[model samples]
Each structure stands twice: as C-alpha cells, then as structure tokens.
Target chain A: DAGVTQSPTHLIKTRGQQVTLRCSPKSGHDTVSWYQQALGQGPQFIFQYYEEEERQRGNFPDRFSGHQFPNYSSELNVNALLLGDSALYLCASSRGQGSEKLFFGSGTQLSVL
Target chain B: GIQVEQSPPDLILQEGANSTLRCNFSDSVNNLQWFHQNPWGQLINLFYIPSGTKQNGRLSATTVATERYSLLYISSSQTTDSGVYFCAVEEYSSASKIIFGSGTRLSIRP
Candidate 1:
C-alpha cells in the first residue's frame, strides 16, 4: 500500500493567482477530506467528498472548492488567493462510514507572495 | 461547531524524562486521533483512541469520553520525539468533519 499521496510538495504563487493541489487517497478508501494548517497551528477542515459529491464543509470561504473523482482521488482548488492563503494543505482519507482511523498525506506547502 | 483545546502549548524535557499532553473537546465525538507532525510537515498517525486506553511501545493514551478529555503519555523520550502533537476529533453531530487542536510542541533534549 502506498498510503495517501499528494502532488507538488511545494508551490509558490502570486496573491491573485489560482492554485490546485491534488491528492490520491489510500487504496480501499472512498472518502477524501482537505484541511489547512497555518504556521504554529493545527489543521482546519476545509471540506470532505464522498462518492464524488461534497458531503460536508467547514467555515471556509467560496474561494476554496474541491472535487472528488470516481477513483477516490481529490483536488483542492483555490481561486483569487490572498496572502493569508499560504499554509500547509493536508489531505486525509478513510473508509466512508464507521471508520475511526484516517490516513494523511505529507501535504502541500503553499507560499503566496 | 466543536472546539478542541490542547494544554501546555510547549514542552521541553530531558531525554530520559516522561511527559503528559492533554486534549479537551467541547462536545461528544465519534472519532478521536493523535498525530505527531515532524519537522517535514507530515502528520504521522500515533493512535486512534476514541474512548479508552491503548499502549504502543513507549507511548500510551487514555481517553475518558464521559469527561471529554484525553491524555497522551510518553516515556523515555528521545530527541526524535521532538514534534507537534495534535488531537483531532469528529463531532457526533457532524461525522465527516474533523477538528484539530492547536497542538503541544514537545522537545526532548539530550
């Protein structure tokens, strides 16, 4: 098992630019969730997708949206990014129901200048 | 929304010392997990403890669900144990969303 995997370990963009971070969930998992972690802080839930549909969302703004594919992989897209958007983007995956454990990817470090 | 809080925002101890980190949640949760984030920013799974006691090697955890608190104990710590420990929980009202605590920064010195 390769575990959860994320692409573009590091990224840099301008304040108004858009960014997309991708993640591949672990095998035999059907749900993917995204989180944001700023410096010296814990991860904050962005949203979660199941069966290619967004199941739940956190208190994030409209600029943050996500999509889940049939394969259970996910993409987190941020538009009109702000300087405050810079943070470590984390992705976690687990079975859809009654699953207590989650497998997390290393995360993408986004630096907005 | 549920809130998670961790105690002793920062801790430093000698390699041979033992320490305890605490987590308190504001509501009932269906799931709770402990993670160790290394300097490289990877959240390594430590334990998925929701309501009881579990031991793995030199580390152990006890979760008292009725009190809405959890404790993580580390024994004979090493320098490699220096990292941020986080407690994440999924509120029973919202099963899919997970909230994380600010975390306790643990540093074990030689």
Candidate 2:
C-alpha cells in the first residue's frame, strides 16, 4: 500500500513570494496535518484538517494556511515567505479525527531565499 | 497546552550497547508516539503507545499515562541506529494537535 505522498519534494522561493506544497494522504485515511521542521530541530505542528475544515492550529502566524479537499488530499500555503521560512514541511495522515497513529510523508524541503 | 521534554539531548554509545530514552509531558495526553529520524531526514514511526507497552524487534516503548511519561528502550544498538528520536503527544484538550519534544540525538559507534 502506498503511504502519504507529497508533491514538489524540494522547492525554492524568494522573499515576499508565496508557495504552496501539496500532499496526498495514505489510503483509507481522512485526517491530514502539517508540520514544519527547521534544521537541527523536531517537527512542529502547523495545523490539522478534518472533513474539509480546519480543526486545530498551532502557534503559527496567519500567513500559514491550509486546505483539505474532499479526497482527503491537503495543501499548505505560506505567504510572504521569509528566510526563516526555509525548512522541511511535513505532511501526516491519520485514520480519524480521534487520537490515532499517523503516517508521515517524506516531506517537502522549502528553501526561502 | 501540553509540554513535552526529552532527556539527554545527545548520546553516544558503542555498537552492541543499549540505552534508554525518556520523555516527560506536563499534562495528560490522548496520543503518544515515538519516531526515529534517520540521517536522511525521514521520520519513521516507531511506536504508537498511548498507554501500556509495545515491543517491536529490538525496540520497545512503554507509556505511563498516569505518570505522564514514556520511555523508549533500544537494545543492541547498531551504527544504523544513529539518529534523532522524538516523542510526540497530543493533549486531551486537542486531539488533532501533536506536540513534539526537542528529541534525543543518538549516535552509535562501532
């Protein structure tokens, strides 16, 4: 079975520009969450989407937004990117809205120049 | 908000040795998981032990929800075991949000 898949394994964007990373969740999973991992750091929760609606969010700014399609696929958009935005953007999928095991994707490496 | 802390920010062990990693949370949680991030930058799920104990191969994890802590034990470590081990948890207040600790960097030498 295929695990979570993320598009644009690597991306580069200049300051003040915007970028969108996509994710296809694992089979039979409905919930999707996004995380950001800086160099030499652990992944930090960004937000979660369930049933096409955002369920919960972390301490990220408003510039960081996400969308969940009916197929359970997800997209993470970061606007006005800054050098600090350079990091690995990870996507994880779970079976339900409850606390369950999550399957993670290899992640998209974002390089904000 | 729940807070997670991992002990021994870094560790170096000889091959065939064993080690234990600890994770402590400040609040109760409904979800707890252990992940091993190899040098190649892949987060591999190790265990999803919210409570009780589970063992897989040479790795075993036990989560004591009542005590708000979890421990991961690695036996007969190999050079391939070198990586960052992270403990993630979700508080009862928000099940969708999973918070991660700083992680324990483990390096096994031959």
Candidate that would win on DockQ: 2
Note the Cα lDDT for every prediction shown.
0.94, 0.95
| Tens-digit lDDT string for candidate 1 (B33-101) | 999999999999999999899999999999999999999999999999999999999989987789999
Supply DockQ values for each candidate.
0.76, 0.85
What is the C-alpha lDDT profile of model 2 across B12-45, one tens digit per residue?
Answer: 9999999999999999888899999998788999
CAPRI tier for the interface of model 1: medium
Task: For model 2 chain A, give the 10-residue run with minimal summed lDDT.
Answer: A95-104
The segments of candidate 1 whose C-alpha lies over 4 angstroms from its true place after superposition are none
Give the residue spans of candidate 2 off by over 4 A: none
